[model samples]
Target chain A: MSIPITESITVIDTTLRDGLQIEDRVVPTALKVEIARALVDAGFRHLEIGSFVNPKKVPQMADTAELYRELGSLEDEGVTLYSLVFNAKGAQRAVDAGALQVKLVISASEGHSRSNSDSSIAQAGDRLLAAIQVLKANNVAFEVGTAVSFICPIDGPTPPQNLVSILEPLVAEGAAGVGVADTIGNANPRMVRTGTKAVQQAFPDMPITVHLHDTYNFGIANVVTTLEMGITRFDATLGGLGGCPFAPGAAGNIGSDDLIHLLHREGYSTGIDTEKLAGIRPTLTRAIGHPLSSKLSTIPAVPEPAPIGRASR
Target chain B: MSIPITESITVIDTTLRDGLQIEDRVVPTALKVEIARALVDAGFRHLEIGSFVNPKKVPQMADTAELYRELGSLEDEGVTLYSLVFNAKGAQRAVDAGALQVKLVISASEGHSRSNSDSSIAQAGDRLLAAIQVLKANNVAFEVGTAVSFICPIDGPTPPQNLVSILEPLVAEGAAGVGVADTIGNANPRMVRTGTKAVQQAFPDMPITVHLHDTYNFGIANVVTTLEMGITRFDATLGGLGGCPFAPGAAGNIGSDDLIHLLHREGYSTGIDTEKLAGIRPTLTRAIGHPLSSKLSTIPAVPEPAPIGRASR
Candidate 1:
């Protein structure tokens, strides 16, 4: 909202993890690797493939460790695979998989924290602190992510102070990056700008990533605000694949295809190949067993994206 | 992209005209009247009720004259009603219906002009010129609008110069405003900013309204860019309820309900009541005989929109 965005951004494709976690059908680990590779071919260097939570609770992501190990070679190609770890057990799984990086997520609001995981923010932090031990023990670099960083479905509008409070403890534990999520996709641009500013102010040294859901179609606006504030890391699902099972009307992260198209059209290079995006979209539709929600996914046959006014970095 | 948006915006709801034009089943006039009234109650000062196109060509809008007459009293409340007119015959219909204002539209690109109206842009411009004589003869104020203002479905990206060339003649005829449309919704934010800026610079004394479709989900991002660049007039449908029959994969305009929510959330008021928006939405869903596409419509029950940091102009 303040500055014009000209810098190249790191778009984290979270299709395998956040996208599939809410689905009743569990995507097999091989198919997950295929989608992951398709994304890497499309030029995504950072990816969030799965979370190491309870397999029983999120059966779709039960193969997190396996998927992480399978895609481990991507690190050689300069691609960083990410997983969401909530506790020491999840952290142990990360270590077992030889993970290079992991995103440790805790809900910012008590209501979401309780619903997403049966614990309050304090209790989740203690679990995360323990998880850090396991991650540090194995030398895995971890980024801390907060769910409902902008607005909580259960509680209400989250004050920016609450986000800072929750992340203060985690960031102090040598977290490499701080992640803010609009878990319900209900945040206004102003709220996103203010909250993101607060997080940047609190931990100016930490790289900030904004994870967005398009439940209310405000995801792109939040993307605009976050980019304007000079923060560039964004987490999105390919073809908008994920939704929250706990939040009644949550939508998937904003579509990576759509976001990349916007970025490329605005002269920012994501290094992701837009033509290759079409190849991976059908796999998602066929595997997810439902029609996709991304705008590009619904089109009959869009010409491979036209990069208009591409800005030279 | 250059200015901070701090002004009140006029959101013109085109649900009755463009929203219903492509539907096979023509909506009864009574229902159209009911929807118009509901929009006015929601604080929409400008409403596009219908277009005076040939009944056989676009049967859905055959009732344009009737709807205009039925809602004539709203003009007393400072509500300016708009209808799309293509030729002198359409302009005659508007004058006969006691119209105070009308938006005369022509395609900006030759390919779209051929497909949409079976004529080239120059030929269609001549027809609009004829329409202007009839409008001026009756002293009815008019605004000139161009379809495919940013990109044509058949042609590639529209150069900004093309918009100015097509609009120059019409603007010279004492037109009150200029309307630029991304008729196919393929416009990215940069295209929108460049095109809109071209129009603003060419017609420095005139009001500019942008009509957008969401075929690519860039509508909201374009909305952000256009608003940031200080264009205050927008056109949208009630539930993302419009599409083009000639355009193979066109989606509806960005939803009025969704746009109002975004505007309100950003501290800008559209003079539209968000609470009343929900009540009128079901009427549209029922009339359209299909599920609506607005993000707000898809959600089971969105808490009435909250205007965070509402700005007072």
Candidate 2:
């Protein structure tokens, strides 16, 4: 039987970059490269390997250049390596490190902007536009990521119209597309559908990627709603790694294995073997020295059925 | 602007009974009564207050009779109090405790039956039939609750045909309705819609209640699908209080506040005041000796609009 939905969904694995940011334990540069290789081997088309932020604030991402260099030498032609950049300097650093795509993040909510970046919304927008210009001059592809686009911890619900107001100028400034991040993990499926609908209405042809956190546990549900809305791209972390150090009580991003399982079960092909994805859980657990918060990690592999009754008979 | 969907969906609060069963802490009888009264005050039409089970095994529900008597004496018109029973003896206890409706639970999955009830599926069916006979003889309004009706913890997914097989005999036994319980908290919205549709097809006129747990965090999502299928009656817990003790690692049931919020937002009138429901969270938290697991608990009442300054000012 031909399935209605095929394995056309793009998996953008952000375990090394975003996952390392929120994790309490600092993953070594070598482990980050190993994770990238594993993610590529697991058929991820996109891998966010690291961020180019200051080393003092985010120690886990200090070895970004070394990690990027290792991944760049890997023979995998299917993987498109990317990194996160908060400013023009970071964007320049990412381009120097040989990253094909550099993601620039700006907070849509003013409260989060002040808390996360110590900048106003307009200032952050200006920074993002400048960074996009720099990346363009360097011949690097870039996307403007709007963090806390759905609901902010301090600001509550973000009006969709305000989000559009921020996006229009960035798209004009050579941003390849816009990525909406649920930084506090509060967006429900309904909110996601409504928010995405609003953005899609404003930028009809703009490619949108949704970055979700599982804090309120609506991550996968929101992904399903987005899928129904014809959004085939999303960001997920291995073993559900990563949460914002600044965003208090924010849990990890949606688990990649859990996301794969949900999509596969719903008849949407994600081109991921869930069992193989789950195999990396132990490595993540040992690296973090604590149990990961993924449901799929704990479940024993479903045993195959034995041949019927010959021995008993 | 009038909304097309029905507003006054019936809220059946199942916290005291189903919720208590999943709790590790033994809630006192007074606290159970307090939760039950709070649920009624929150506009719940039906409340499953407690269960008549062996005190030794489920010590949390040791005072079912006292809890029922206290709630019965309130004489709250329009409120229907229910008690869950597992066998004929428990059914008699429920009826004697002045329960307006007595609910009996049996598993549709054979594996769940063996693990949960320590009996084969056939033996459990016989026990359920005996309990039904007892309820019928007393003319007590009764419902047969099929626990793990959607998916079994040990058996994985329960086939729709297996659910039909279980519901058929119960309908024949004059069951007023059958409830589908996501006992292990493993159901998705599609599974809920499919399972509910199958059972409804098998018994056209029978009332159905969808009891969900938030383990995988699809509780409210499944409820939305249930609503799309025109299922108005559902089981919820105040402050998302309960889970199954037998099913390890299951989270609390869908919070009544969150469910009411979703229904009201979708143009369905639940006759529940969102503010009042949120206010009850603290009381439940204090009684449970821990904070409740609801998203809406801390949401400040959506403040009324501030007055605009005069043009002269």
Q: What tier of docking accuracy does candidate 1 attain? A: acceptable
lDDT of 1 by residue, B267-304 (tens): 67688887798789889888878889988888776664
- In model 2 chain A, the worst 10-residue window by lDDT is A304-313
* Candidate 1 clashing pairs, residues 3+ apart or interchain: A242-A252
lDDT on C-alpha atoms for all candidate structures: 0.85, 0.75
lDDT of 2 by residue, B1-313 (tens): 1125565788788877777775678888877777777767767778887788898888878888998778896545877877888788888887788776778788877777877778988898888788888888888878876888776666666667778897788778878888888886777666677788888888789888888887655677677668768787888887787877666666778888777766664557987776777767777777678777665653334332111121111
For model 1, state the Cα shift of residue A52 in Å.
2.0
- Tell me the docking grade of candidate 2: incorrect
lDDT of 1 at A138: 88
* Tens digit of per-residue lDDT, candidate 2, span A55-124: 8988888898888778886535867887888788888888788877788888877878998888899998
Provide C-alpha RMSD values for all models, in order: 4.2, 4.9
Q: TM-score of each model's B chain?
A: 0.94, 0.92
What's the TM-score of each model vs. the native?
Answer: 0.92, 0.83
Q: Which residue pairs in model 2 clash with each other?
A: A22-A243, B7-B269, B22-B243
